[model samples]
Target: MAILTNARMPVETVNFHLWQPCNMKCRFCFATFRDVRGTVLPEGHLPRRDAERVVTLLADAGFTKITFAGGEPLLCPWIIDLIRLAKGLGLTTALVTNGSLIDSGTIRDLRGILDWVTVSVDSVRSGTLALIGRMTAARAADERHYLDLCDRLKDAGLRLKINTVVTAANHLEDLTGFIVAARPERWKIFEVLPVQGQNSGKVEPLLVTPGQFARFVARSRSVEAYGIRVVPEDNDAMIGSYAMVDPAGRFFDAIGNGYTYSEPILRVGVRQAVSQVTVSRRKFLARGGLY
Candidate 1:
């Protein structure tokens, strides 16, 4: 469904997740990477014209940052072209990745096209790989490769942020290894939500409660003593200041709230969708949320 166009909403970030298909099968994916065969729906991908128009729309709507995400955004052959288009429009670009498909070639291509790259590094232990069902590479290997990719991107001088999805599986575990080892420009800690799975209706029960969250914040902040910047997204006012769009240009009311709008945003192109949606920022922000 598309968002209803109103004159009171603000459009902060527009995410263009081109595909639902991914290379890895992470158990925590709210998208349910295991049940689905990584299908990129017909409406999921943006053709050249659609992409160009989306950029134009974002520009017209006054959006400064456009994020390109995906099952693995690199899977979209036209991603670099889209980034260039966004940059040409004077918009800052970002990428959300699992850091598996990236290599030297991809890094070279993104040198200037993107302003930031957020990589998901949930855990760094090899033993945990089997737990996450990524035993093929071993958990340690996955973490190592992600760190290696981060190093490569940093060496290339691109800005990088390491995002960790906190869950029941790894909560009490020592994340200092990640703090000391990854040492990224930013370390984002996210509370695990059920949207990644069909049975996600049970997610709340699985989440770290408010008291637990407070403790998580404290421990995470202490990481700064070790030289890493930890940004926790828990009950923070600024969290409400930002908005996210899905792969289809649907502005997310919350992480997995599904497209908050009533129509498929891609129907009109990104620019129009953004313009139509952002004009109603106030109501959009107030549409029953807890940022």
Candidate 2:
């Protein structure tokens, strides 16, 4: 049975994957955008004015918050300009990055307008990160590097979020100690997901059983006492819960197995474009997408 929605959609948040190139190649990344990378947009992203237009369209569409993510958003040269413009438009801005490019300079650039910085830290161990392809170099201070990033963001008065995807490689590793030390405002623990068009075949080795994912969640409970909201998202909880956009500025949704994309919002306009895919505000809330 199909669920019908009202025409009046109150979009609270949207994740804008503005860039398609990344420095670090994680094995389980679902936002690779490899399919549309060179073919869809020649520059790997929308041109400057078009990029700003997309953000403007989103703000005018009344989205409360917009999360800037990418293959690695920091790699995009003009992303700060977009972030600053989004803030000026009255939309709460957030960034999801692998944390490699973030430095004192980047932090200084985002100090006032950027509300949250969510870093993807699956494991502090270099060997495991190598297996998962999260990071290439075996830096001696890997643990210290990430933990320090938490402190730096917090010190800048920007909210911190740590996203740990429990995979076969790090499912057994207890990240509670790290979580306690870093002390982020929110710790989002996601079971390694396999999206068809995104990471179907590539995600198989990284996938964990539900029980294994459960075990990881159980051990992570200790962080709640430290005022960290540990939110676990299994596959079911993640489906159809987010309003996500691709690098070419089109709305996309995760269907039964593969992804279904809308006509580019730039071409079709916001309402027609968003209507091409189904989004559940009810599901979004249940998944704790807000805050």
Q: Pick the candidate with the highest TM-score.
A: 2
Positional deviation of residue 90's Cα in model 2 after best superposition, in angstroms: 0.2
lDDT of 2: 0.86
How far residue 240's Cα lies from its native spot in candidate 1, in Å, is 6.7
Model 2 ranges off by over 4 Å: 1-10, 136-141
Residue 76's C-alpha lDDT in candidate 1?
80
List ranges where model 1 is wrong by over 4 Å: 1-11, 31-40, 134-143, 196-206, 235-242, 254-259, 266-291
Candidate 2's displacement at residue 199, Å, is 1.9
Query: What would the per-residue lDDT of candidate 1 be over residues 19-84, giving only the tens digit for each residue?
Result: 666666666555432222333345455566766675677666666777777667877887888888
- With candidate 2 superimposed using the best TM-score fit, by how many Å does residue 112's alpha carbon deviate from the native? 0.4
Tell me model 1's lDDT, rounded to 2 decimals: 0.61
**Candidate 2 on 113-154: residue-level lDDT in tens?**
899999999998878888888874543237889988899999
